[model samples]
Target: MELLQLQYFLVVARLEHVTEAARSLHVTQSSLSKTIGRLEEDLGVPLFDRVGRKLRLNEYGNKFLHRAERALFELEQGKQELRDLSSPEQGTLELAVTAASALPHILREFRKKRPHVQFHVQMLATQEMVKLLHQGDVDVCLSSPAVEEEDIECQVVYNDPILVAVPKGHRLAERTSVSLTELKDESFIGVKRGYGTRDLADRICKSVGFEPKYVYEGDEPARLSALVEAEIGIAFIPSTARNSRDQIQYLQVENHELVREIALLWHKRRYISQTALEFREVVADYFKPLT
Candidate 1:
């Protein structure tokens, strides 16, 4: 019934381990167990199925988890709204980004305008970003293949064209454009599969009837350029991340509309702080020229 009880139960439901969850919650295991028991008693149903030291969310717990999350989300929004009212000029913006290439420019421009404002940036995969946004963990998300959840507001900020990057001496480097089918046999360097760009590239390649053979899969987009430059493999890269140095050549994707729609997403009903609004404006301004 108590807020603390709900909070504790949610944590236990997530971890599914009493000792681990209690350690993370910074409470004694017995105390955490007692709290969860009280919450289950209040609800008149057992939330979790117990097996020795481990716990698993039962059907009831799975159903209640969503409600608990929403309750906490609303409470957090209320707190943020009050904080924004008290300190309109200074606040931390929780930003999650899947489009890592564009983030530096956006943050730089935003910092120039609001030096007093701060940022907590998370480089997250598309699914993780969406999950956090729904949970109210992030204020906003810059994502690709925009999130389509009914409760989330997603607006396209930039239509970033995807291109193929190759080392200077590579045959594709001389071509101004190449089709996805042409790169079928080429060894590739790519970001990991979870990344927006990587997923998009895979889908586009699949559409053309082949999957790219990644010689090296990495986490950093910046490293893709380096890998291509070393002739380890060619890569599908966003136009915004095209390297200026002649060592790498960026070729347009011919016969396909290979573009990632970079989007800004936030919960439509969540309270938006003045600083967050300003930050959104900054993001819009930064991507305007690129679009």
Candidate 2:
């Protein structure tokens, strides 16, 4: 019945491993187990089903978890609201993004306007960004993939075209544009499968009747450009990724609608502080002219 018990149970339910959950909670395994046992006794029902050393949430636990998560989320939002009310200008803004390509400009403008506001930024995968947004861990997310959750508000900040990048002396460097089919025999350097750009590139390639053959798969989008510069492989780079690097050529994809939409997302129900609201405004204004 205690708040600590609910917190511990939520962690255990998420990890499904008592030892790992106890470690994460910074408590002894026996203490965590005893607390869970007491919680079950007080509820008059077992919340978890024992599966070897792992704990799986039972039907009752599954039903309770949703409410438990909401309770914590509400408490956190209330805390943030109080902090905002007390010191509107000075607070931390938790932000997550898929990549850092568009961050410097946006953050620079935001910081210039709200110099007292601090920022905690995380470069997360598309799925991780969505997960944090749902958990109320992040105030906002800047991502390429459009989030379609009902509880979330997603606004398209920028629509950047995806360009095929090649080395300066490569055969395709002189071309202004080329079709996806033309690169069927070309090797590519791409972000891993879970990345938004990588997924888009894969889908577009599949639509053209051939899967892209990758010479390397990595998590860093910046490294993909470096690989292309080294003549290792060509890559699909976003327009935002364009910089002063002269070693590479970015060509448009011919007859293909290959574009990535950068979205600014926030939880609709979560309390938004003045600082967060200003940050959102800064982002909107930053992209206003681009649209």
Candidate 3:
């Protein structure tokens, strides 16, 4: 019934190991177990099914977990509201981002405007960012291929063209633009499937009646320029990520509107603090010139 009990239960439910949960919670294993037992007694039902050292969340636990998360989120929001009322400009913004290339500029501008404000940023894939937003774990997100879910306010802040990057002397390098069909047989370098850019490229390539022949698949989009410079493979990179200093040639995708819509996303029902609002404004203004 206590808030602490719910907190402990949620951690245990997530980890599914009493010892691991206790260690993470920084509490004794016996104390954590006792608290969970008390919570089950109060609820008149067991939340987890015991199997050796691993504790699996039962059907009851699954149902209760959502309610527990909502209750805790509301309580935390109330506390944050009180804190914001005292000093509206000085607090942390919980932000998630899939559009990593645009973050440095946005954050630099944001810091200049609100030096007292702090940021806790998570670099996540598109689906991961969307999940965190729905869970209320992140106050806001800057993502690509804008989320289309209901109850989430997603606005396109920038439309960055996707370009094909090649080594300086490659056959396609001299060309101003190349079609996906032209590069159907060429080796490609790409990020992993979960990434928004990679997914977008796959969809676009498929539409053009070809699948990209990826010679190298990596998690870091930042490495694309370097990889292309090394002649490892050509890659589909966003315009914002292109650097003139890199020894690579960027080509436009001919006859295709291959642009990624960089978006700002937030849950419509979640509490929005003054700091979050200011950060949102900062993002909106940062992309104004680019738009």
**lDDT scores for all predictions?**
0.88, 0.89, 0.91
lDDT for each residue of candidate 1 in 1-291, tens digit (9 for 90 to 100): 999998998899889999999999999999999999999999999999999879999999999999998898789889998898898778889998888787888888888888999889998888898898877788888888788989899989989999888899998778899888888899999989899889988998898899999889877788888888889999989987886877988889888988999889998888988877887898898888766
- Best of the candidates, lDDT: 3
* Model 2 per-residue lDDT tens digits across residues 22-111: 899999999999999999999999999998769999999999899999898788888888988998768889999885687899999998
**TM-score list, all predictions:** 0.87, 0.87, 0.86
Query: Which residue ranges in model 1 land beyond 4 Å of their true spot?
Result: 13-17, 33-70
Candidate 2 TM-score to native: 0.87
> Better model by lDDT, 1 or 3?
3
Sort order, lDDT high to low: 3, 2, 1
Q: List the residue pairs that clash in candidate 2.
A: none
Q: Could you tell me the lDDT of residue 169 within candidate 1?
A: 92
